[model samples]
Target chain A: EPEVTQTPSHQVTQMGQEVILRCVPISNHLYFYWYRQILGQKVEFLVSFYNNEISEKSEIFDDQFSVERPDGSNFTLKIRSTKLEDSAMYFCASSLRAGEGDTQYFGPGTRLTVL
Target chain B: GQQVMQIPQYQHVQEGEDFTTYCNSSTTLSNIQWYKQRPGGHPVFLIQLVKSGEVKKQKRLTFQFGEAKKNSSLHITATQTTDVGTYFCAAHAGKSTFGDGTTLTVKP
Candidate 1:
C-alpha cells in the first residue's frame, strides 16, 4: 500500500530559528492535512489543504505556521520561529476525498525538538 | 465543544482477555473513525462508522456507532500482544479532530 512519507524523521532546532517539515503524500490523494501530537497528548489538527489552498485551520495554527504544496508531490509546513512549546510530532496525512467518511492515511511523523 | 472524549485513558488485559474503549463527543458528528498507533508508530486507520447505530466487525474487533452519532466504542475479543497500542476515535466533518485515545496493553 502507498503511504505518506515525511523527510527528516527527527528535527532539532534552536529556539527562534525557522524550520521546514516536508512530506510527499500518496500519489493520487487530493486532500492533505497537517497535525501535531504533543508527547502523551491527543492529536491536534493544524491545517487542512485541498487544491493547494488551506480549507481550515485551528487556533494552534497561528502566525508562525504556514503550509504549501510547492510542487505536485511535495507538501511542506514551515514555522517562522520555533518555540519550546512547538516541539511535537508533526504528521502529514492525505485522503482520496475530503468527505466526512473518507479515511485519512497518516505518515510516520517528523518529531520536532526545540531547545 | 467539538472535543471527542475517550474513557479509561489506559487499559491492561491479559492474553485472551477482552478489552473495550469508549469515545464520546459533545455534538452530533457526521462520522467517526478509529485508528491505532503502536509505540513509536503513526496512526493507522482501523475502521470508519457513518450511519447511526451502525456496527462493523473486523475479525476479532467490533466497532459500533451510537444512534445519536455522538458516541462510539471499540471492542476487542481475546486480546493478543499485537493489540497493544493507543486507539483513537476521530470525528469527521470538514476536518479530523481526534480524541485523547485509550492505550491498551496486553500482557502474555
Candidate 2:
C-alpha cells in the first residue's frame, strides 16, 4: 500500500528559529491536511490544502504557519518562528477525494521539539 | 469548526476482556471515521461510517454510527495485549475534527 511519507522523523529546534516539516502524500490523493498532537492530547487540525491552495485553516494556524506544495509530491509546513508550545507530533494526511467523506491516510508524523 | 467528545478517556482491560469507546457530537455530522494510534506511532485509519445507523466490523472490531449521525462507537471483542492504543473518532464536516481519544491498555 502506498502511504504518506515524512522527512526527519524527529526534529529539534530552538525557540524563535524557523523549521520546515516536509511530507510526501500519496501520488493520486487530492486533498492534503496537517494536524498536530500535543503530548498526551487529541489530534488537532491545522490546515487543509487543495488545488494548490489552502482550503481551510484553524486558529492555531496563525500567521506563523504556512503550507505549500512546492512540488508535485512534496507538502511542506513552515513555522516562521517556533514557540515552546509548537512542540508536538505533526502528521500529514491525504485522501483520494473530499476529506469530508473519504478516508484519510496519515503519515508516520514528525515529532517537533522546540526548546 | 466542529467538535466531538469521547467518553471514558482511558480504558484498561485484561487480555480476554472487551473494550469500547464512544464519540459524541453536538451537531449532525456528515461522516465519522475511526483511527488507532499505537504508543509512539501515528494515527492509522481503521474505518469510516457514513450512513445513519450503519455498522461495520473488521475481524474482532465493531464500529457503529448512530442513527442521528451525531454519535459513534467502537467495540473490541476479546481484547489482546496487542490491542493497546488510542482510538479516535473524527467527525468530518468540511474538515476533520478529532475527539479526545480513548487510550486503551490490555494486560496479559
Candidate 3:
C-alpha cells in the first residue's frame, strides 16, 4: 500500500540552529498535518494544511514553526531556531478528506534531537 | 482543539491473557481512530470507528464506538508477547488530538 514517507529518519542539531523536516504524503491525499510527540508524552498536533494553506494550528506551532508544500509531493516543517524542548518525534499525516471520519495515514516520523 | 483521554496508563498481562483500553473525549467526536506504536517505533493506524455504537473486529482485536460517540474501547483476546506496545486513541475534530495512550506489556 502507498504510505507517507519522511526524510532523515533521525536528526541532531545544535540549539538555535534551523532544521527542516520533510515528508512525502500519499499522492491523492488532500489534507496534510504535522504532529509531534515529546519523549513519554502524548502526540500533539502542530498544524494542518489544505489547498496549499494552513487550516489550523496548535499553540505549540508558534512563530518558530512553518509548513509548506513547496512541491506537489513534498510537505515540509521548518523550525526557525531549535530549542531544547523542540527535540521530539515529528510525524506527518495525510488523508483523502477533511473530516475525522477519514483515516489519516502517518509516516514513520523524524526524530529531532536538539542539544 | 479537542481533548481525548485514555484509561489505565499502563497494563501488564501474561501471554494468552486478554487486554482492553478505553478512550474518552471531552467533546463529541466526529470520529475516533486507534493506533499502535511498538517500542522505539512510530504510530501505525489500526482502525477507525465513525458511526454511533459501531463495533469492528480484526483477528484477535475488537473495537467499539460508544452510543454517545464520546468514548471507544479496544479489546484484545489471548494476548501474546508480540502484543506489547502503546495503544492510542486519536479523536479528530477540525484538528486531531491523541490521548496519552495505554501501554500494554504482555509477559511471555
Clashing pairs in 1: none
**Model 2 per-residue lDDT tens digits across residues B72-108:** 9999999999899999999766667999999999989
Which regions of candidate 1 fall more than 4 Å away from where they truly are? none
Determine which window of 10 residues in candidate 2 chain A has minimal summed lDDT. Answer: A95-104
lDDT of 3 by residue, B18-87 (tens): 9999999998887899999998888898999989999999999999999999999999999999999999
**Candidate 2 segments exceeding 4 Å error:** none
| TM-scores, each model vs. reference | 0.98, 0.98, 0.97
Candidate 2 vs 3: which has more DockQ: 2
Q: Write the per-residue lDDT of candidate 1 for residues B7-76, one digit (tens) a residue.
A: 8799999999999999999999889999999989999999999999999999999999999999999999
Worst 10 residues of 2 chain B by lDDT: B90-99
Q: Is candidate 2 or candidate 3 better by lDDT?
A: 2
lDDT tens digits, residue span A1-115, model 1:
8999999999999999999999999999999999999999989999999997999898999999999999999999999999999999999999999937898999999999999
DockQ rank, highest first?
A: 2, 1, 3
Better of 2 and 3 by TM-score: 2
In model 2, pairs of residues that clash are: none
